[model samples]
Target: MKFTATQTGKFSGPGFTARCVLGKGGVVKASQKREGDGASPAGTWPVRNVFFRPDRLDPPVTSLPLVPLKPYDGWCDAPDHRLYNRPVSLPFSASHEKLWRDDHVYDVIVELGYNDDPVTPGLGSAIFMHLARPNFEPTEGCIALEQNDLLTLLELMVPGAEIEISF
Candidate 1:
């Protein structure tokens, strides 16, 4: 329902309507698994929780709701580990692991549900709602936008904010 890094050209079909999902920030740099870089990931990811600017309190954390950080809260993207398709804790060492790091980027994440598949690692890992670049380009398998826009949407989002991406 929200867009961050939108392309300048005329987008057709699903991208033609205002209702169809759109991306705005970090678009130029977006990447899929094969392109090596500059491609947006494709899949439906469930909004896990919401994070807000600790200073601003007027807008209120409405959409999706906010869940406090927990010690065990994590999403697994490690292809080699046994917990490859599940959540794991810290102090873990692996070859293809992508645990939620302690950075502001992962602060507001929407846990993708596709990677849970038993057959594959479910594409890449660490997809989230991060701040967009100043130019508003593509992202690295994650949706992005200006910090202000993100906060505004967060305030208005519903409990089950779903991000469905299709090619």
Candidate 2:
């Protein structure tokens, strides 16, 4: 199965469609994507895995591999770091984003296989499909969707599903 997200804020799968928000800088070609550029990379990225906050919600219903998030979970985004674009433990001495956010946004996260193929440095990192803010605000560099909509999409997604993002 394949899902798609467009620049117009539309995210749709086989039978469901929901509004979504992209990166603040909008969408850009994968080659043009850079660290901290605030743009969603354009390409079909596989769904690597799902991470959910076990403290806040029960495990989500989906066919995708699921991991309960730990408070120490983090993703290194520092371009020059060896662990760039990879998950690292907290207190990690490199720049990273805390998967355990104070906000509800990261309660459920869909890890997108962006820039992780060979872990290119400075190409961008931590690109995920996560819960959107109440007003559907733009993300720093990830796709955002409402909680229910995201869960629905997850339910429809299969193990080998990929999300095709376009500008």
lDDT against the true structure, per candidate, is 0.47, 0.94
TM-score for candidate 1, residues paired by index: 0.57
* Poorly placed runs, candidate 2 (over 4 Å): none
Off by over 4 Å in 1: 1-38, 51-60, 63-65, 70-75, 95-103, 117-119, 133-138
lDDT against true structure, model 1: 0.47
Candidate maximizing TM-score:
2
lDDT of 2 at 124: 96
Model 2, 1-167: lDDT tens digits are: 89999989999889989999999999999999999999999999999999999999999999999999999999999999999999999989889999999999999999999999899999999999999999998998799999999988888899999999898
**Residue 103 of model 1: what lDDT?**
44
C-alpha TM-scores of all predictions: 0.57, 0.98
- Per-residue lDDT of model 1, residues 1-167, tens digit only: 43222343222222222211234322332233422243455554566656433433333456565644444456555665677655566556653323244445444444444344432543455556555555645555566545655565565556655555555
User: Each candidate: RMSD to true structure?
Assistant: 6.3, 0.6
